[model samples]
Target chain A: MKSNTYKEYIAPVVVLVCICLVVTAALALVYGVTDPIIKKNSKATADKTRTELLKDADSFTEYKGKLVVEQPGAVYVKDVYVANNKAGFVATCVTKSFGGALTMMVGVDKEGKVTGVKVTNHADTPGLGTKDFEAGYLSQYKGIGELKATNVKDDGQIKFITGASVSGSAVHYGVYAALHQYKDMGGVK
Target chain B: MGKQSRLRILLNGLIKENPVLVLVLGTCPTLAVTTSVENGVGMGVSAMAVLVCSNIVISLLRNVIPDKVRIPCYIVVIAGFVTIVQLLLQAYVPALYASLGLFIPLIVVNCIILGRAEMFANKNTIFDSALDGIGMGLGFTFALFLMGSMRELLGNGTWLGIHVFDKFIPGMGIFNLAPGGFFSYAVIMAAVTYFAAKKGAK
Candidate 1:
């Protein structure tokens, strides 16, 4: 009877615990080796993205101020980097889009004008939601000082893709959040 | 089961017990990642790595593991291998990692690995189980490659990002959608079934 109980309960428990320990040990070994390389790769990508968005800036330092944007879950500021050359401030903002969160970088100059805009990561629908993210569409944000309204229907400053309003407005709000973050920081201070 | 030779065990997964086309396991990643050849191949190879590793470990531990908690043991082992593959991909091959995205982590739940662990690995010797892993992995990869080629070629008018039919035949946009995935999967499944049936009759 004791042997039966051991087989039914104790044996399984011991086996499972041992398996868990071995798996965890293996995972920790792999993670320790790969973590640094992953971090380096992402940092390199971020640096490259920063240079692309703010062409004239030679270097950037992350803005130290706390981001206090009160927008809902759909839009929020991720990070803001200030250009040392006074070119502009690059703001990374994530906004809810068609498929999922759309993360984009918007560079705003000291004069409160958009220098450039680039999408960093997004799960937006390909072909449809991506229509708004085209170089032609995103380029319109360049030289525009500020947005007056939330979407294309209200704000004539930006022209949206005909069938992708959700994505378009998502991007519009992303840019809005970035610009708002820039304004809140009061330029390169 | 013991009567089967090593070569037959290895080759069995290619057609008779194919995880994707014949058995129709892991349809989620099979459909989701096959939109592009690059993504499809990437996902296939990644999943194959996990499957092979998990099968070997599960086979080795089959005798030691208690039958009552074997499923949970298999899951922990499979999930461990998946994370290991995920980390390695992120560190070494960032491009493939980025393209594959959420599907990488989703491999943890892939039924093929668990199915093999339960069905083949536990019953077989270590060498035979490893061969099964390789055979099944190759079959899964081959299936994804075929589906990815068809979808990428028809939908994007390109093969592996190279412009193939673009100059002559315009891209069929529907082939890039979810419906297209199901359509292609069904068509290929029917063809495989037809040939498989013919072979069985012979």
Candidate 2:
């Protein structure tokens, strides 16, 4: 009975525990080596993106002001960064789309005019909803100073990609919220 | 197991017991990430790395691991290795890591890794098990590449982002969607099956 109990319970338990310990130690060792490199890569990507968006900006300073939260037309602003050279503000916004939340960055120059809009991350459906994210479709928002209404039907500022209106609206609203952030910040104060 | 030549064991995974084509393991990722050649190759290479590492470790522990808890032990080892791969990719190949996204973590549950652990690694020597992993990994990669090329070419009129027939013929947009994925998968599967049958008849 004693030997059977050991075989049935103790042996398996001890063996599993030992395997778990070794695996955990191995994971910790790899994590220690790679964690810093991962952090550095992401930071570098973010910096490069910001520079591309605001071409004249020498550097960016994260905006500490109250972030734009969920509202009627738009979702929420994820982050806002002010150009150190006073060129503009780059606002990251998350808005609802066909697939899920669509994250984008909108660059607004000092005159409250739009410089560029880029979708950074999105889960929009492939081939259908993704059509709205194409550069040609997003390029219409460039040089626009203000948005009285966010949707294409309301304002002719931005056109919707045919067969992907929901994703188009999501991209539109993302820029809407970003411009709102710029206005709220009173244009890079 | 020792009776079989090492070369045969390594090559078995290519066509005979190909994990994606013959065994039909890991169908989920096979369909989901094959929309583009880049994503397909990236996933295949990442999976191969994990498979080779896990098979060797599991074979080495086969004698010491108690039968009752072997499954759990295998999972822990596999998950650990998957996480290790994930970290390295995130660090060194951030673009691939971003494109793969959720699928990277999902590799932990991929049946091919666990299936090899249960079937080949437990019974075979470490060297042989490693060979099986390579063979199976290559088979999986080959299957994914074939599907990726077909879908990307017909669906998007491009291969690896280079436009193939955009000027003459517009891409059938449906090929990049779910229905297109299923269609391409079925066609490829049928071709592989037909070829295998002919080989067998001979």
Report the lDDT tens digits of candidate 1 across residue range B45-153: 8778888888999999989999999999999999988888889988999997776665667688888889899999998878888898899988888898889998888
Q: Model 2, B28-90: lDDT tens per residue?
A: 878877877876887788788889999999999999999988999999999998888888888
The residue-by-residue lDDT of candidate 2 on A1-189, one tens digit each, is: 999999999999999998899889988998999999988887787778788878988889999888887574449998888998899988888898886777888888999888888887776434456668878888899898878677755767676755567888888888888888877888777
Q: What are the models' TM-scores? A: 0.86, 0.86
Clashing pairs in 2: none
User: What's the distance in Å from true for residue A97, model 1?
Assistant: 4.9
| Docking level of model 2 | medium
Worst 10 residues of 2 chain A by lDDT: A122-131
Model 1 clash pairs are none
- Mark the 10 consecutive residues where model 1 chain B has the least summed lDDT: B97-106
Compared with the true structure, model 1 gives a TM-score of: 0.86
TM-score of 2: 0.86
Q: Give stretches of model 2 more than 4 Å off.
A: A71-75, A94-104, A119-141, A144-173, B1-4, B93-103
